[model samples]
Target: MEARMPDPVAGPITEKSDHPRTEGDPQEDGDTPRRVVLADPRSYCAGVERAIEIVERLLRDRPGPIYVRKQIVHNSHVVADLESRGAEFVDELDEVPTGSTVVFSAHGVSPAVRAAAEQRRLEVVDATCPLVTKVHAEARRFTARGDTVVLIGHADHEEVEGTLGEAPETTVLVETPQDVARLEVADPEKVSYLTQTTLAVDETREVIEALRARFPALRGPGSEDICYATTNRQDAVAAVAQEADVVLVVGSANSSNSVRLTELAQRLGTPAHLVDSARDIDPDWVVGARTVAVTAGASAPPWLVEEVIDALADLGPAIVSEHSVATEDVLFALPREVREV
Candidate 1:
């Protein structure tokens, strides 16, 4: 079957005007409608940018059938586009022919997985986000100090797996405050903590507090482990959710960061939905909503946001607005192989 591609780029859906609503000529009723608000820090993050760059460079320089260890990022559209361009995604190195070029996903990989790829002699390209790499380093540091490390993240995520591998025997995964309560340590005094870079900030805080209560001497990262991109996007969503009648998050269902955005909106007491693209938007939910907030996950492309806005425009004469909470300038460099090629 042919792979799917992202929606073709349409021109910018948002107008540059600062006005909340452009004058729509004098209405007979003498009332101007409110505009839809878009979150500024909504789209791709540095890690995601680097991941896509790796695939693009591979397609340009490498021959046919380059293997990727997992979804290049988390977006189906990105995976499909890369697959259409001759990239093959496999879950295991065993699936990749020996000596073939294979790129790792943005979510880092375990040492065992790396050893397996090395055993196969695959030409590997590491696309793990630098921020994730920092977490892996912290895990190793904690382990070296004879500390029982606690990892705050989803158990099965690729990034968590990789970080855990750095200190498997000592690392414990905690998803909630309850998990922290249930945790038993060989020595409470020697415990430290790290976390997945894309978790919900508020949820992670509660878990951290739980851990701190149990292990008074517990040390942690100088800053929160949740990445700036995740925090910023959530903050932007929350800013608009305060006023939006309904909120829509653009991303794949399996995407962790995307799911968090939807949950954040709902937690703020607003109805929110996660849609892979414009096609997933339900007209019924949006029909009566005077205001809607649209944001995208880190892996999601900005074009998807434009597509959703275009679809909303068809439903009614919509005015688009933007609310920017913060600016992000973080950038990650491509793997050496990709750069050299």
Candidate 2:
């Protein structure tokens, strides 16, 4: 069945009682069923797909030990898969044998890293998500205008790090509303803000509000920098969280967007767990949950999400359905280097 369009103005996100009777479901309870509701637009955003494809194509076309600077998008499964294909994951460009081909992760990289790769004369294939690159562009433009850029994102996040490196001397990082309060900018009147593309939308909004309150003249991106995938998945969770007794998010602990989905569900008063795969789904967590909401991080592969659904099935028979908040049609073109490949 087609999903109903999400109406944000709709009342509290509520769980429905239309559960299917699972095999092991103690017949003691009434006809309430045990089921899993899958969130649409859940995994492998355009950027992640492009990043992974870049490596796959590179592997097919090049004779390499193709080196990737980061996890290539933060999913353990993805990195492992690429590793099995002869892609070397490294923390630094120095690890690449000077002349070997190298790829930057989808998370983007600092200018210094790019310079390092160039200095080593390494053949580079950049797989930075176009949306993240947009944030970096904002940072450069704001700093060039003499505005002190206040980047609202986790301090250590790769996306944030790359954006900060755009104009480090002119950019400052703030993670929360409180950070805005304690921030001491050189000129409040000339301040601007940008954000990590995958941050939790609601939390980032609060931080933005805090920044504006402190500096009424604060500037921000002409259009918000949080990517469509992040907003869509977060909104998708909001639509189903109210109806789910419990929510299970599939992705690595370090996946910011995946973690935010868990946080979003929790904020709605539902118990949520962040799992790397089906292996982490604790049978104990779903003890009393009649309906479970399943979603995957933007960087996560669909296979992991499927594995989770299978794991949930072992708990009992489940009516798995897709709860789509919105349809996503965004696509980014491959980098020029591999466009022909």
Candidate 3:
């Protein structure tokens, strides 16, 4: 199902003023609030919240060690926090004991992984994002129609891997438009395309355009595969990046959407960095920057954003305002496995 979020142009909470502190002046001595623009619709999409809650409920209700396959979400801090509370994250199903409860990650899994879990008799609680599940369903549908499916995303990403597994024999992964030229389909006229939910919108559009050029009869999902959260965050970043000197995206290194935010800001001619936390922020990056824009990925926790602002405040008195692009009120129901508990 699609996220129930409104798509709108970003509106600034307050009018930004010129830098009160000059380059030659000391940042610490500034009397004005240091400009910090926080992007609205940042952090913890509904799918991520659902996944984390499923694990938390299982940990609280069940006494046994709760096993999770891969990260419940992409954030390292989230994984570490859960690990401290007795959630065991594993690389493979073999690491989990037979007949024990195991939660699949939010990225979803291939049919092979599900079959492997079945063989081991692991009690499974799927935490796959509904959006990702939608992509998988599309893959299966296209493949069943005897169409060669072209998946757009990084080959190594967990989300892409799971989606690729949906129709391995019929599916091909393409990261860039250049890969489209080398693609070979059994029936050129009967090809369809799908994208990872977390890819950059502009880049994915380019790739889709290339695919259409190569195969004019290309089929696709009824709606774009990029989730609403990803699109909104990118739009927010683009808005702040234009007015900010430097942009800092709060999320782990492996988070695809977080990295996309940094890249988007850089593409807009603003210096940007992907920081896991405030400590990762290079002091130099913000020393001369008057307006520092901050945003978090879907997997990132909201508290982390506050911490970054606190860290920035340490440098000087900061004026923090949110530039909201959209309001997100979407909520996904807890999986049946953990719903009652």
User: Per-candidate TM vs. native?
Assistant: 0.91, 0.92, 0.95
Per-residue CA lDDT of model 3 for 1-341, tens digit only, reads 43567766868566434322222234754565568888877999999999999999999999879999999999999999999999999999999999999999999999999999999999999999998999999999989989999999997899999999998999999999999989999999999999999999999999999999999999999998999889999999999888999999999999999999989999899999999999997788888677899999999999898888878877766777778888888888878878767
What would the per-residue lDDT of candidate 2 be over residues 69-172, giving only the tens digit for each residue? Answer: 88999899999999998999988877789899999999999899888888999989999998788888888899999999999899788888898899999899
**Model 3 ranges off by over 4 Å:** 1-3, 15-30
Please give the lDDT score for candidate 2. Answer: 0.85
Candidate closest to the true structure, highest lDDT = 3
Which candidate do you rate higher for lDDT, 1 or 3? 3
Comparing 2 with 3 on TM-score, the higher-scoring candidate is: 3
The models' CA-based lDDT, in order, is 0.85, 0.85, 0.90
- How well does candidate 3 score on lDDT at residue 44? 94
Clashes of each: 0, 6, 1
